[model samples]
Target: MISSKEIKRKPDQDASKHYDSVIDKVLQKLDTVCKEVIDRTNQNNQQENEEARFGQQVKQKPMNEERKEKEENALLLQLAEKDKGRLHLFIKLVDYMTVETLVSINQTSMSMLLEEMKKERKNGLFNTAVNFDVQIFTPDEKEISEHLKCLLDDMIVVMRNTARVISHQSMIGYIKNTKLGELLSEQKENKDCIADVQGIITDSIEYQNIKNEIFEKVTSDFQAAEVYVNTNYMRCKPIYEFLNTWNQGDFENKEHTLDIIKSHVMELKKWLADINFYIKDIAKGILNVDGKKIKNKLQPQVVTKLENFKDYLYKLMQKKANQTLTTLQTYTSNLSKNPQNLKEYAEFIEAIQEAEQNIKGLETAKIEVEAMHSLLKSKFDLNPLKNSDIVMMDDIQAEYLRLTLKIKEAEELCKERKQEMMKKHEAEFIKFITNIQNTTSSVNKGKLILEETQPADALQQLNEIKTRSLDRFKELDKNYQHYAKLMGLSVTTNKDLQELEATYNDRRMLWTHSDKFNKLYEDLQKNIFTTLNVEEIEKEMKSYEIGILKLRQNINNLSKEGRDKVLDQHANRVGNVSQFMPVIQALGNKDLRPRHWKKIFEDLGSAWQPGKTFTLQELIADGVMNKKDKIEEISAKASGEASIEAQIEDIKSKWSQLSFIVNHYREAKDKFIIGSLDDIIAALDDHQLKVQTKLGTRFVAEIRPSC
Candidate 1:
């Protein structure tokens, strides 16, 4: 501190040394911290590797176990499926064997009897209760012996295979316990019986020995087989129970194992039940003591005869059942076509009752015949022909209800027919009025008591109208002759007036179609209220108009004169004209009766006016002086002698009367068309076709009964 430069040097040296020491201390602390970080990183990596190895081991063990379990489940399912299939095939084979045994029996006599029955039915001589005894039936000894040997061999093969199948290797370990031992023991007994039967069948050389020994052995073997089947059937229950429980339990995370096994179990149970029933039936059939005793007592030929008789009984039952079904079907078909008839349905019911009584106790010991028996039962129980006594009663009651419905329907149909007849009568009445109006009749009547009258009464009124109308036509002839006589003139008044009117009206009509008249008419129309010299046209027009008017007046006056003359004559003939006046008036409007006549008159009248236009060709075609010619003709006729005119009028009146009567008759005969109901007539034709169709169907359905 005394010397300033020395002190400064000393302090700088100390500071430098102190700074070196601080840097070394900091370096040591950094090394220690880095070393500790490296140790922790190493430790963490080692721990992770160990954890990964342990997790892999854990995962692999479970995966292996799961895979193994899946394989085991698949194997078990496969074996169960195979066993179930085998069992189904075995049952079918057994059934085939049993049927074969029955078929091996002699069937010639039975077949002949059935043929005879068919012939009787075809010839219409078959009676439902007819009976015939057939020759005895028996199996061919040689053929049956051979068949038995083969059958026994097949049965032994099946039993041996079944034993192997139920062993531990095939049964999915289910029979790994005493179950297999039990099955083996029962199988041994069945094998012994089959072997014994086969030995007896093979040793017998003669037909008689073979028949006796083979049948006895067959019976004993069948009994043993049935006993074995029953034992197995009982065993199946336990087996199925175990299988069902096992199928429902989960194993190794496999899917649908329970479902798969349950299906197999169900199939197996059904098979066992069927087999058990079959076995029981077989045992009963084999244990037919009466049959055996009969065979034992009888000679071989007699035994064969008894067998044929049994076969006939079986066939009779079968055919009767078939025939009953066919008969019921026929009755049903008949009922369908003629549902109103109760007889067909009643017969069907009675037939069902007959079948029930006839086939009550009929049965066959043969398995093949049982198949036919099942078919027969199905025919009676199935659709369309299905009926029991109770069902028949129910149907009968239902049919009675249908009859009640039919009664209502019949009443409705009666009312419809009545209404239809009334409609027809009313229509005829209208037509009668139309005919009367069309004729020169004195009286026209169309008013019908349609609602108030019955069909019969209405038809009577229609007939009366027709008859009266026709009678009036006959009266017209007398009136015409009397009027002609009363005229006492050379010309026929009514006839000449009719001719003159027609000619004048026709000429007037021609002017409208005349070019000269049309041009003059146009000019007159144009010159009206003007200074045009249309006098010539006006003069022509005036002449035509005055001529037409004068002609019409003459015609009207002649018509009135003729009518008055007729009335006066009628009064002379009848003593009074007043009573005939009403009849005359009714006939008076004959010209006005036609619906188109009024329109025709109006058109003609309107067209004959002044200033009407026309075409040139129409005038030449109509004849320009037609009215003048007709007037000259009329004058000429008027100039004739009165006697000649009277003669002509008499002939003309007679001709008119003949024409009117002919037309009236023609109109009356065709009333069916105009009077009948359109719908009812159409329905009648359709109903005929439907009846033909029904008859055709009946003929076709009759074939089944013959069959």
Candidate 2:
């Protein structure tokens, strides 16, 4: 181990010592130069201060004094020119020393020392150049001062360039040490390692500051180096942002995520391509590599990874787009099958809207993917996905159009159907109105008939009208309700139908009371002779009277003018019954024999016989008297010779009829020829006529001749 290795190690140690000694000497000379510059600047400042203190007391100087001042400034410029070369050499040495020192130091220490050097240089030399006092110095002095400042600025630029080179080399060394290039080369497998490298490059404050310094020092001297550092830094910054901002879950099969991935990939490709172009010249100068080689190392691999990731995203997008298309197709197909009703139509419309939204999303997705494709082709020269891979909005729009056409056709059909239904309903309504009007007319006609007809006949006619009207009204009301509901109209109330129903109800009530009274009167007539229950008959008559009163009240309650007509008819019927009620009571007596009844009926001029049906009209038509009046006349005759006189008159009337028949037979016998058939028929005809003439003399003479 001590043989050849020790000999080689000794030379490297000596070289290191020599380099360190050289850097120290350069730094010492730079310090001396800086001190001389600081003293000269202080002297100039003092001279300026003294001139300003006396400038108000002596505003204008003489031409000779000004020439003298100029000569003095020229001499000072000549002296500064003599020291300018040394100052330039010292600044060069200082710049070289600064680069070597930065190169020799660790990255952390170099970064800290560089920051301090930048601050000191800016505060001292840069400020001195920027704030140069032209008023205090002569023209030659100002020219000399400008030349010195330019030399110092050049030295500072070289120092800054050296610092940038060292920083770039350090960054490149760090990249190499971390195997960042290898990680980038195998980004798919070493994704986490690349991510970590990106994190270091982006998140490290020291690295960021160095990168900023390189960018700030963008001059012709190190423009390539700045671009190189910036390119590497930019390359990692986006990757860092992307990697840190997103995760595997963010790449879901959704439009928003797909769009985000597409945008990021496109931006990365564009940024990476721009960075490659920016550093093309410097690639060989500073980094000692070809621009294309660097690009091929970084861009192609990164592009490949992006292409793969984009491919994954595209596949997801395709899958999602296909699903959306399938959903849209299904909705369109279902919508094409026409909806039957409002509810189904509404559901179809909602589905169509959702389909439209999905179509919009698909279109957006397609645009995003196509944009990514365009970026990749123009910038990265990648063609992983074809245009056919994208979902077409035309197909979706066509489906939507078909859906709309179907909807339009369905709407037209519904409109036609509605119009047809409305026509049919209108016809039906007209028929209903006509039927109601006819029913009302029939009721009016019945009302007219009620005026002239008997109570019983009026009741019958009213009942018929009520039945017909009720049937018609029920049908009309049912139809009205059904049609109204179908048309979405309120069917709860109809003034015409309600009024008609009320009229029918009122007439029914009037007839009902009339029917009750008629029934009571019939009972009185049926029970009058069937039983000797006079008190029951009187009770029935009282009930009949009460029924007539109620009927009259009901008639008065009627809104129609027929009330008085019905009332008058009912009153006439009741008056006819009352006029013959006493006769009915007298005929109901069970103590009377059939002969007495026959005699009484004969005297009353009635055709009614015993065991036959009796009625009040029959007795009224026969001019019958009251039972009380007949009894009073009989009692007064019984107390006098009225009964004997009535029997003598009866004997006289029979003796007279016997004498006349004997006289007529004797006359017929005297005129007759025995056994002659013609004479016998003639004689019979003569006797019949003579007897009829004698019987007709007791009856009232007819005012009108018989037909």
Candidate 3:
């Protein structure tokens, strides 16, 4: 049987089970999202052929109707021609501003030309209806205006329709062919036919095809190129490839590159997303092919920047390919340090705060425990009981009762003895009692004599006296000891109560810091009080919490870390901020840019026609970057020096002045001994460094085939 002893028993609450359930739920949700993503990918993959087929269908348009209905469509053609003519005039006037500004000026000038024509007509010096609106414009004017209009429209559609098999029908292509044919006999303002007319015609199919082919894979190449520009062309080749490749495989193993692409997108989006991001003149030049000199200077810089950017993007692609052995967890161990994982680290702070708060509450709880101990100790006297007189009270009471009963029985015998003794004494004392006894003795003797006469009365009187005496004595002895025990127990209760009070007072001090207790409580409420299992909560925190907090704090503070840390953050933050990485990359990329890639693809198709092994270097020298890797024979003996060394030497020669100033400043300084010499040395050193560092690297590895 269980003893009826009350004790403080500890309770077992299985918190871990609850926590596990929560974690399982969270992972299940994530799995669901993953499944959905996979399902969507499968769906897209299944429909790719349909998309391609649709593209082919979109290529078929009513070309014959457009050709035959020229007079009815004369306004559009006339406007197209006028636009080309205006483009030439505007190109000369390109040093100025917007199409609005240029067009206003052009319109004013055209008005005067019309006015002159009107005067000539009045003088009978002109022929036919001189309608500027109806008349066809010059080739350059039509080229410029229509190009502008096309840019404003869907450029992809225009490029496709112009170069596609079904719609291989650009006016420029037709006009260029006719122009080439009549070049010897007659020529019209032929300054703009560019790179080479004969070479352009020779590679016309290739050029057209290349122009048709996407130079920029809008998502990958552009995104990568965006990063390339931001990081500079440090890893230019990889950026170029990334920007130039099929982006349908864009996200395959592209975690790092995705971030970079995102960052690139953000920066490039800053330039492109905003209609007002660039200057108006630049925008106007970009919008319309005005061939303006002012724009010409800027174009090469932008293009070069774009090219260098492409290189950087290529490197990023390389980086994406070069996966490290360490897992993501290794990189995300202390997310606070990794700016990339900042988003995930925010919650970790909350968890830590909760833990710390829980610990604080535990301190209070510990104090409460001590209070409970004091309460128990006070209320229950578990302390040893001192030896008491009560221990023998029962035995003594029993013995006393037995003796009383025996004595009562012995009363008769004692009375008989007394009577016998008294009989002898009575005779002798009779005379003395008679002589000495007063009324009481005489009465007692008389009563004894009466009792002798009536023994029952005397016996009754004796029994009553004995019973009352016994009861009185028993009450005194037993009640006192029992009362003492009760008193002792009361004392113990009071003592324990005092102790508990003291303990409570001490515990109360633990609650003195209300802020801490409340905060801890709040943290508990925030972190774990709800569901329970949060093991990976810590893991997730380790992955993303800490970093997020640090970043948020830093952002809030409007402060920055050390330069090295900032640099690291900058690299990491490249993609963390933006989702528009592709646009920037495409805009900045040289290889993938429609202008460059289109030419290359077209030339490749033309040159590498079915049965030919063309001289690749010759094309390369002519600024044609063909899209294939090739190896050519070379003799080590004939080339006594290494290709890399020779190329390096050439690079050194080109950047000789820059290197000289930066490299030999210290040597130059020591050679000077005077005060002015020190200043001269400092100035020269500064100048040299400024020149060299600012000049940047201009080395081309392709030249050496090794550098």
Candidate 4:
């Protein structure tokens, strides 16, 4: 009873199972083979034990053999001489290695030398391999000889010792033959005596073995500490996913919305899956291989509804038929009876007949209304009936049924006519619906591919549309939310619409004001900059007023802290002005010398010292400059120095030291602020004017002693 989806194997399980079975079978075979190998290993182990024991017996005689070798040193010397004499080729090659010959010269000589070296290296390797092949020797390093040569020589010593041991053992065994029975009896006695000490010795040996085994075990544990791993595969993914899912956020005051959202998400997934082929077609269309996307998307659709305008028209017609039948019955019966109410009955019959004839027009109106309704509904949902069973006619059929109360005598005719109309309506509706459904379903599922339509551009358009729709939808949703809280279907929407219109008008007015304010702000900036001889600056210095205004504005706009910085900038600019002022001042005083200038400069430099002062008239006398000539003379003189700009700086520096107190007093006298050069001049005017009334001397006097 499991669905196919549920019955399907989980991912990788089949491959995993197959791999496991194959590995298990291979490992089982390997285990059997390993068992056979262990058996062979045990058999080999027994053979190795026997050989080792036999070797141990031979090892027991090595102590005795060493003593014999010490006693036979003289004979060994003789054998060594014979062995050395056999080394004729080795000695001859060593003799050839003189200093210059060993160091190869040209390519030819190097080749010959390499050949000789190879021969020596080969001999060394060969001697070591052959002589040391059967000897028990430790590889001890010797600095004087090469490694192979030393190994071979050491092995020769070991081999000679082995041979001597064998010879000594053979000699000892032969000598024992001379006193065989007594020696054998003594040997048996010694063996019995050694057997008596074996138990105590074995106890000591067993204790040492236990201690060694413990040491080995501890070291084995140390080595085993290098690597480790753990295993846990069950329930990890499921638990992690559950934890992650539950840890997410929840909706506020609308928990059921989550279920609805989940449903939407599932539907979205279905839509995406179903759209895969459509997306592929889109991609192909983008490649411009085909171009029929929009046409396919916009094809007109058909809708069927028994509960529509056409049905209402059919019912109206049926009602008209009933009325007609009733009117005929009344007219015929009245004509036969010759009654007084015949005129009234005949007039009623005429009215009913007229109404019945108008049914055709009513049906036509229903058809028109139904056509428009069908267009909107069918385009939205082609098979809406497939998903709905609840029904109610909103058109002609409903109207026709409603009118049945006016004519009880013709109910059967009305009912019969109603059935006929419905059958016809249904058949026609179905035919139209089926044709549209087939067309829509068979429309090749065209992609909305654009030939040259930029996807990004189209996407942007789509995004704009989506954004607009979402904005409206969000507004609608927000309204609904507020509505749900306030009314919950209590208030009609028109009231809210009125409120919205008022708010929109207010916002519109505010936006208009904002735009006007922006325009005025820009005009304000331009107007401010244009004031204060902006044109005069251009005429005089070719420096547009823009730069000057900008500079001044920037200074004014600076933070208070930044503005309160040192007047060094003013001093510097004064110096620059001073450079041009002096030459002009000296124009009328051609007899002026550098010495006079020095004296005036000194007086100005010292005027503002703690207790010092120099009168304005005195300074004028020192410079030999009068009021009429002051501006021109100062400017021309100041502009004359080698570094006019630096000289101007010197001039301003001197002016500041001498005039700072005077300038301060003048500012208090006239309420002048010290922002510009003109302010200083204005302060000076006020000071002079004030002092002139207070018994100040008008005549010039030398400001400096030397002057």
- C-alpha TM-score for every candidate: 0.11, 0.25, 0.11, 0.14
Output the TM-score of candidate 4: 0.14
Could you give candidate 2's per-residue lDDT for residues 158-276 as a string of tens digits? 22322221122222322333344344346535442222222323454764566455334322213443345455534444543444455554555444654466576767667566646
In the range 558-623, model 1's lDDT, one tens digit per residue, is 342322222222123222322322222222232222222233223334234333334322322344
Candidate 3: where is the Cα deviation over 4 Å?
1-291, 326-707
Which residue runs does candidate 4 get wrong by more than 4 Å?
1-18, 38-42, 51-321, 333-707
Give me the candidate number with maximum lDDT: 2
**Per-candidate RMSD, Å:** 42.9, 42.3, 55.1, 36.0
CA lDDT, candidate 2, residue 217: 36
Clashing residue pairs found in predicted model 2: none
Comparison by lDDT, 3 against 4, better one: 4
Write the residue-wise lDDT of candidate 3 on 129-232 in tens digits: 11112221112233333332332222222121221111112222222334332551242345332212223222445434433332222223223323332343
The lDDT for every candidate, in the order shown, is: 0.37, 0.51, 0.32, 0.34
10 residues in a row with least lDDT, candidate 2:
122-131
Rank order (by lDDT, best first): 2, 1, 4, 3
Clashes of each: 7, 0, 43, 31
Candidate with the larger TM-score of 2 and 4:
2
